[model samples]
Target: MTTQSAGEPGEQGGPLGMQIDHVPSEPGGSGTPGPPGPWQPNLVSTPAQKKAAAQAIEDHIEPDTSKAGDHADDETGKAVTAFAPKDGDGWVTSTSLKSAHKTWGDQVKNLMNRLASEKAALRSTGLLFQTTDFGIGTGLRQTSPLDGY
Candidate 1:
């Protein structure tokens, strides 16, 4: 379930229920204190997100949560991105951290296992070695030759 916590998947294949609470703001007060820095819009995960997930796993075999994604000064400023959503542009999910880690580990392991089964000729030329990047955003394998190897 989506509500997994590392070792076991929950009954629902996801967290049992998802709820959101917006942080309260003081009356007549802005969220920022200084000028905004370089504007880097949040990189949204497209419907075809399997690729991104694969990349994140390869680049970061173990997510530290402290440095998951891009961290530019946001529009509202105030170091807001540390809580940006893991999937798209929002907030860090309250889902089980344990489950997320296990899931990521399995993905990387499976890819490596598959790579091990490849024919030795191609494997020697640069098959498995070519795909590994020790970085989450770069490890994802490209589906099209048009994309970089």
Candidate 2:
């Protein structure tokens, strides 16, 4: 006959042949409690809910073309003016203001590129949410706007 302790290895099907030393008590236990388990929400999203969520993400991914174009044009003008030769008769004209203007123009260009990259990343994420299977069995199918792209 084989005998095992109540909390011993494989006694109650504990993980990895290890015993559970302590069970979690209610709040306000003297000993420090273990980390919480993974969260499992009881609620499931309906088709309408899924559609609304996908639409919201899609809307958020849309870039403001007009504003982006205006900013790009303004920044290009500033860069051209900053690097242009001065009216004075000097071989090289390097002023603090010109340097600052050049720096500002470069910063503007960096900001625009960063914003575009971030938008592209967000759009890709949104598309993933639309196409990837959630495995929730809600019978909801999301279609990405960039499906053909």
Candidate 3:
């Protein structure tokens, strides 16, 4: 188990602020064997860090999507419909505009949903790591000769 210090809480380290302990040598191949010693955590997130990250996503990213989506809708829906009413001149262009508007709206909605899920995942990350570390530490402690004291 390699023991390298992790980044300070809430400080982004690597790209995406993530680490992977092992990876397969090739597709369908086994990953690096488990360490002979206790597990070492290379990435860590505190409760405050998780909360702030999730909150930032909610406050900044989620709200901006509406503004952006509305801009696209107005440009595509209102402008196109004005120039080419659906049943009149430039009807083909109007139909195309409607399709584009719907596609843009759907994409925006999908992005918002993905961001929400990511925020939820971020909020729970600290707790998940704490629980996992505690369980592993407890198991390792039980195997120690020091426990006989």
Top candidate on TM-score is 3
lDDT of 1 at 147: 69
Q: Order the candidates by lDDT, highest first — what do you get?
A: 3, 2, 1
- lDDT tens string, model 2, 1-149? 34465555563576343345664364545355555434433466555665565455445433454355557667756665665667753323334445655676677667667656655564466456666646443456557698879
Model 1: residue 104 alpha-carbon error in angstroms: 0.7
Among residues 3 or more apart in sequence or in different chains, the pairs in candidate 3 whose N, CA or C atoms overlap within 3 Å are none
Q: Pick the candidate with the highest lDDT.
A: 3
For model 3, the local distance difference test gives: 0.76
Please provide TM-scores, in order, for all candidate models, with all chains considered together.
0.20, 0.30, 0.56
Estimate the overall C-alpha local distance difference test score of candidate 1. Answer: 0.43
Candidate 2 collision pairs: none
lDDT of 1 by residue, 1-149 (tens): 22334545456464444435444243333534434334534564343353445555445643432233212112223333444465676554323443455565566566555533432333243333444533444646546777665
Model 3: residue 121 alpha-carbon error in angstroms = 1.0
Off by over 4 Å in 1: 1-95, 119-149
Better of 2 and 3 by lDDT: 3
